[model samples]
Target: MIAIVDCNSFYVSCERLFKPHLNGKPVGVMSNNDGCVIALSNELKALGVKMGTPAHYLKEQVARGEITLFSSNYELYGDISTRVQAVLEEFSAGIDPYSIDECWVNFDGFAPGQLEDHARELRRQVKQYTGIPVSIGVAPTRTLAKVANRASKKIEGFGGVCVLYPDSPQTKGLLQRFELGDVWGVGRRLAEKLGNMGINTAWDLRNQNAKEIRRRFSVTLERTVLELQETPAIEMIGMDFARERIMTSRSFGRLTNDKGEIREAIRQHAQRSAEKLRKQGSLCRAVLVFLRTNPHRQDLAQHNPSMIIELNNPTDDSREIVAAAIQVLERLHAPNKRYMNGGVMLMDICERGTEQLSLLGTQQSDAERQRSEKLMGVMDELNQKMGRGTVRIGTPSAGAAWHLRCAHRSPRYTTRWEEIPPVRL
Candidate 1:
């Protein structure tokens, strides 16, 4: 059997971890710049505020303290997610992370009859160890596990764990009742297309001929069709494969024409991208930088420019990557453009040992490569041990325009010593 364990209202649950008093209260977490709601608690959902609703739209409710809103606290969320994954690792035969808040758990040696009990125990232990509530779904296929997991979460009688067998009557009823869009890979548009063909439920899609589905739509959809019929066809290739390109970008706290601030943002992004590249044991041959004005506002003059700069050698060194990024920025930077966003992309990445060396042997010196590796390794280790940005490429300018506007952010209760919660005796 396969199982998937998913955290419940993950972001809101993380916030509530520190402030238990907020339990059962309406709460939402916003996106970067606190622009719109991205995570919602059940209480918040009951209050009719939806995902992506503008944060300003809830100003009156916030003013009256009816609902609490928080800026996206990635540091806290990431730490909690790691802790949860660790707990899962201790129990299951094997665990594969589906996302920060979800993982696929394999039950290889366990008895089928005890799967639900075992899954419940897994849920209990995760809560006991991490103080985070999780829901588990067990089924023959990963897709059905996802469906059962959603049912366990959204249904009340299941008590956080639901198990379904391919031939079970309960499974049949579920597939019949579930909307086609709720199937693992079906989206709104695809569901609409399937709906027109009378494939309006999970059962209907499962009944379709897989080859016909492939001919009509795509191989991926055909895989989903087979998966719905309890065949495991979807392979998480993207999750298993190393990324071909790495990108880091974000909207600024406020728009600015200051070249220094734009440089600062791109510099940070390059440093971050380089960190990822090294972590994956890959090197990039080029760095791409782009600057853009806010596309939503029409009153302001607009400019979006991008440039890619090649490095002397394919490398994962932060210094070289940041230098290449800055070169691109310098060439693309247009004065008085009031750029609201900037980004860095590491392109043409390959495994460290597989990079094509220049034929002339006229590349970064051997000693320089060794030193870069040592320095970057030390920097990564220090930052990992002492928190990110402890040993960064450069000091960020105070009041930099690229800084995020997270005015209502909660403390980094788990990751930062200074932000850890206080106890009253």
Candidate 2:
């Protein structure tokens, strides 16, 4: 059987893990740049603070003590997620971490009754270890397990675990109540098509002929529905090996008309992206740099220019990537234009060992590559031990007009010593 485990109010739970006083209080976590509300606690939801509502729009409510808001604290959340995943790893033979707060576990053994007990135990262990509550859904298929999980949230005494066995009467009732859109693979467009055909419920779609569904839709969609009707066909497994891509970007803290500042911003982004490339054991063959003016201010002159540069060789070396990024930045920069934001994107990534040699020119010597690797290694280690920007390129500081305005950001309570949040007795 496949079991889907999802953490409840994940961000709020993470905050409460360190600050217990927030327990049962209205809380919400903001999105990147603290622009909008992303995660809301039960209390916050009850207070009518909807998700995605901009922080600026909620100023009045916040002033009235209707809700507590927090900037996105990824460092704290990432640490807590790791703890939660570690607890999950102990229960199942294999686990597929779906996202920050969700995972799918393969429970190959144990009967129906045993599965229930296993689910309860998993929840208790995770909560005990991480102080985070989770809901578990067990079924023959992943889709049914998801539905069972959502249903479990409303029921009491389930201990956050719900199992839907195909042979049980509850399974049929659950299928009847589930909407097509609620199913895993059914998207809005497919759901609308199904609604038009009167296949509005999971039971309705399940009862349809697989051959007919295949003829109406594609083979893939038909297979998904058939799997949902019986048992989940997808296995809980690790992600497939594929090339990675890194896009690093940031907006200037203030708009500037200086060409030097624009170049500096792009160079900083490129350096950051190259650092990430080295960390991931990959090299880039191409880099893209772009600059843009503020889109919201329609009355202002807007100029968005971008350029892509091909590298002489595939390299994870920050120096090479930064050089190529600056070349593109030079071409895209406009004189006397106030640029609001700029970024660098590294692409055509390949493993360092598997990099193809140049056909027209001599390949880099082993000693040269080794020296470059060693330098990058030391740079990364120093940056991690200290803070980011501690060992940055000189160009990043040349025209430092573009910086983040994180005036109200909470300290890196878990990751950095100087930024740790203080606890009160």
Candidate 3:
């Protein structure tokens, strides 16, 4: 059997791990620049505070201490997620991470009857070790496992564990009542399309012929249909680990029309994107730079511009990528337009050694290629060994205007030495 364990309200749960008093309170974690609600606790959901609700709307509640909000603390969340995965690894044969807060555990050797009890103990161990509450759903397929996981979280009687066999009456009942949209991989859009076809419930969709669904819609939908009938169509991991395109973007701490500020942000994004490409063993042939003015600022004149520049040859070198990004910036940046964000995208990427090189002099020579590779390797190694940004191109300014605005961020408790939680005397 396959099982999925998803942490309940992951970000808020992480924040609550260190602050136990906030366990049952309304809490949320804000997006970059305190933009909006990205994660909310059950209490906050009960208060009708949905994801993506602007943070400014809840200012009064924040001040009154009715609801607490924190900026996204990715470092703390990542560390806590690692801890949870480690605990899960001990219970399962192996694990396939679905996201930061979810993992699919392997239960190959365990008997069918013991699955529920083993999953319950796994959840307990995760909570005991990492202080994070998780819900587990075990079933024959990943899609049904996801459905079971949802039930574990939504239905309290299961006590955070649910097991479903294909022929079980419980599975049939749940499938009958569950909406089509709630099925794994079938969002509101696809659900609406299926609803038009009279497939409004999981049971209804499962009854349709898999080949007919594929002919009407997609191969993915066909797989979903099969998975619903207790067939495992989806792989534990998605198609591939390598990304076809890489993008790095973030909002500025404060809006500015300064060309230098725009340049710096684009440069940083380009450098980061290059790092990702190298880490994935890929190379890009083009760089895309985009600059945006705050769309919400209705009072100001707006200019959103973007441009793409083709490199002489595909490369994963930071210098080439950043230079191309700056070149695009020179063309895309506009005068007297207050910019709020910028991004760098590496496009037309391929596995590192697969592309054909150009014969033109614009491409790097043999010696130059060796030098660039060595330099980037050392830079990445130093950054990995010491800390990020240990070896960077150009001078980096700590108090830059383009930096992210995370005023409400909690400490990096697990990752940073100085930010560890204090003990009472």
Q: Is candidate 1 or 2 superior in TM-score?
A: 1
Residue-wise C-alpha lDDT for candidate 1, range 1-425, written one tens digit per residue: 88999999999999999889999999999999999999999999999988899999999999999999999999999999999999998998988888989998888898878888899999999999999999999988888998999899888999999999768889888889899878888899999988888878999888989999899899989888788788888765434568999999999999999999999999999999999999889999988999899888888889999888888889999998998898888888888689899999999999989888877773457777888899999999999998999999889998899999999999999888998899999
Instruction: Give me the candidate number with maximum lDDT.
Output: 1
Error at 4, model 1, angstroms: 1.1
Give one digit per residue, the lDDT tens place, for model 2 in 1-425: 88888999998888777778889889888876667899999988887888898889888877898777887777778778878888888878778888888888888877767889888888999989878999999888887888888877867756588998777788788789888888888899999998999999888888888889999898767777777776555654454344467899987877888877776777778888988787778888999888889999787888998888898778888888888888887787778678888888888999878988867653556668789989988998998777666787763553367866444455666678787777679
* Candidate 3: residue pairs that collide: none
**Candidate 3 similarity to native, TM-score:** 0.91
TM-score of each: 0.97, 0.89, 0.91
In candidate 3, what are the lDDT values of residues 270-348, reduced to their tens digit? 9999999999889899998898898999999898888888888889999989888898899887787899989999999
| Model 3 error, position 3 (Å) | 1.1
Q: Which numbered prediction scores highest in TM-score against the true structure?
A: 1
